[model samples]
Target chain A: SAVISQKPSRDICQRGTSLTIQCQVDSQVTMMFWYRQQPGQSLTLIATANQGSEATYESGFVIDKFPISRPNLTFSTLTVSNMSPEDSSIYLCSVAGQGVGTQYFGPGTRLLVL
Target chain B: AQRVTQPEKLLSVFKGAPVELKCNYSYSGSPELFWYVQYSRQRLQLLLRHISRESIKGFTADLNKGETSFHLKKPFAQEEDSAMYYCALRGTGGYSTLTFGKGTMLLVSP
Candidate 1:
């Protein structure tokens, strides 16, 4: 498993503001993903962070709302733009490990939109 | 689309009793399944994977393609095993993002 760390473990932000969450891995990984878990809901895929390219978002997600930056193999950032109370959730980052389907996740960023 | 289904929202069991967490999947391609666990105040972690075919922490799961199920089981439950368990499925690819089911909160009482 990879050791992953996320910055701003938690933060409360005002609605319409944006907050950027950072994820760093101890070693370079081939894949990195961002997920969100809303209150009483399962984890939802936000997007897949691709190095040197725009992230590929899921059907219900858009880059304009959640912009992702993968500057390198070991680091990525996800910004929740124009946040709302509905966006209050725990955002997590995960990296693919050496084995197939082994995804080690970082401690999630708890975002509370006020 | 690949999807995982964990029917039980919560499972309560007594220590030393048997435990089983049901998981089902809907996928057309070959499925890679995983069981993830999260302790209170801790990050999510992989408990085991179907491909490994190995028991972890006294827990074991067998994939049944015909049934499309991978149920986690343990002969004896422990109080410390109480936590949230998630079943995930990955599409056949190099870096396919995992599709997770609604987690089952296991509560093992002494």
Candidate 2:
């Protein structure tokens, strides 16, 4: 098990503004991921953030809209650019445990775009 | 493409009653399934995984390859069990991303 935390637990941003959510892990991990959860809905993978490399984004999500940076094994950030009402969702960071499929998630950053 | 389907959006059960949250997946190769829970105002946490075959907090999930399903079950529900539950599937090999199902909201009433 791993402990993870996120910054700006909750925020309200005006439309067209941008916000970057930070994710920190207690231990060094090779694979980190970003996810989005719409209001009363399921989780959607945004991208895979690996240290010192370009992030692999999922379908329907582009780097221009949701850019990710994994500078090191223990830290990553996801920035929601040009935010809109539809982009308002709970953003989460997760790290995969070594040699297993289990993933540990961080406390989500809830963003409300007005 | 790998996908997970959780048929029920909401499940309401009485305290001490049996509870089951259905989850099915679509994958070509061997599937690794997991159950994640998010209590109100808390972050999502892994509850159990099929590969581990271990029960956590009185909750267990059995993977049925024939049915391509991994359903979560609890013999006696507790009031604190009320939370949003998500079924996730991992792609084959290390570093594969996870695909999550539309979560099921379990409401265990007192």
Candidate 3:
């Protein structure tokens, strides 16, 4: 399993503002996933960030609203643009294990949109 | 559509008592099952996976493909085992993204 360091563990943002969350892995990884866990809601996949290319967004999620960046194999970022109150949620980054699809998640970034 | 269902939103039990958390899934193909735990203020971590067939902290889950279920069970519940448990399934979808259930909160009392 790989270790992920996520910054801005918790944040308070205003409506229409954007927040960029960063995830840095200790070692190179092939795939990095982004998920959003809203209050009292199940975790939902936002996108898959592939190294050196644009992210592949999930259904109902677009790159314009939830843009992603994977500059290298060890780092990725997700930006929530034009945020609204409904965007308040815990955003997490995960890395898949080698030889298996088991993923290890980071201590999520809790965002409160006001 | 792929989905994972955990019937119980909350489960309570006393120490030394047996415990079982039910989970069911709906997918067209065979899916890998997993249990994830989140302790107070901690990150969501994997507890066990059906493929591994291994027990961690005395917890195990058997995948019953015939029933389309994977229920986590432990012989004797401990206070430290209290946490939010989520049942997830990895289907044949692209990238095998995990589809998680709305977790169940377990409380083990003395």
Candidate 4:
């Protein structure tokens, strides 16, 4: 299992502001994914970040809203742009293990837009 | 569309009681199921997977393809088992992103 560390564990941001959450894995990985978990709701996949390539965004999520960056195999970033109150949620970063669909997750960044 | 369903939002059981957290999936192709747990202050982590066919922390889940169910079960619930459990299914896309269900919060009281 990989140990992932995400920065800004919890943050309070004003509407119209943007926040970039960093995810650093202890070891190199092939794929990293970002997810959004609204309060009392299921997780929704935001995008998949692969090194040196454009991310694949899921339905309802667009790069203009959630821009992603993957500089290398062990690091990635997800920026929630022009945040709104509705953007308040827990953002998690995960990596797919080599052998299976099993994923390891970061501690998650809790964003509260006011 | 690939999706996961966790029917119970919350389940409360006494210690030593049997517990079952139901999960169901909808997918057109072969599906891979996984159970992830999040303790009070911990990251969401994989507990077990249907493909591995192994039990973790005495919790077992059987994937019934015909029923599209992969319910998590344990014979005896413990206080430490209190946590939020999420059932996830692999999407058919390359790299196989996961589609998680609304988690079930299991509160095992003594």
lDDT of 2 by residue, B3-99 (tens): 9999999999999999999999999998989998999988788888898899999999999999999999999999999999999998754575788
Give the DockQ (C-alpha) for candidate 2.
0.73
Model 4 ranges with Cα > 4 A deviation: none
- Evaluated with TM-score, which candidate comes out highest? 4
Residue B24 lDDT (model 2):
96
lDDT of 1 by residue, B1-110 (tens): 99899999999999999999999999998889999999999899999999999999999999999999999999999999999999999865556678999999999999
Q: What is the DockQ of the complex in model 3?
A: 0.77
Residue lDDT tens for model 3, B52-87: 999999999999989999999999999999999999
- Candidate 4, residue B46: the lDDT equals 88
lDDT of 1 by residue, A5-114 (tens): 99999999999999999999999886899999999889998988878878889889999999999999999999999999999999999987777777889999999999
Rate residue B71 of model 4 by lDDT: 98
Error of 2 at A30 (Å): 1.4
Candidate 2 clashes: the total is 0
DockQ of each: 0.81, 0.73, 0.77, 0.87
Candidate RMSDs in order: 1.1, 1.4, 1.1, 0.9
lDDT of 4 at A107: 92
Lowest-scoring 10 consecutive residues by lDDT in candidate 3 chain A? Answer: A95-104
State every prediction's TM-score relative to the real structure: 0.96, 0.94, 0.97, 0.98
What lDDT would candidate 4 get against the real structure?
0.94
Q: Model 3 over residues A1-114: C-alpha lDDT tens digits?
A: 799989889899999999999999999998999999999999999998889778888899999999998999999999999999999999999988753558889999999999
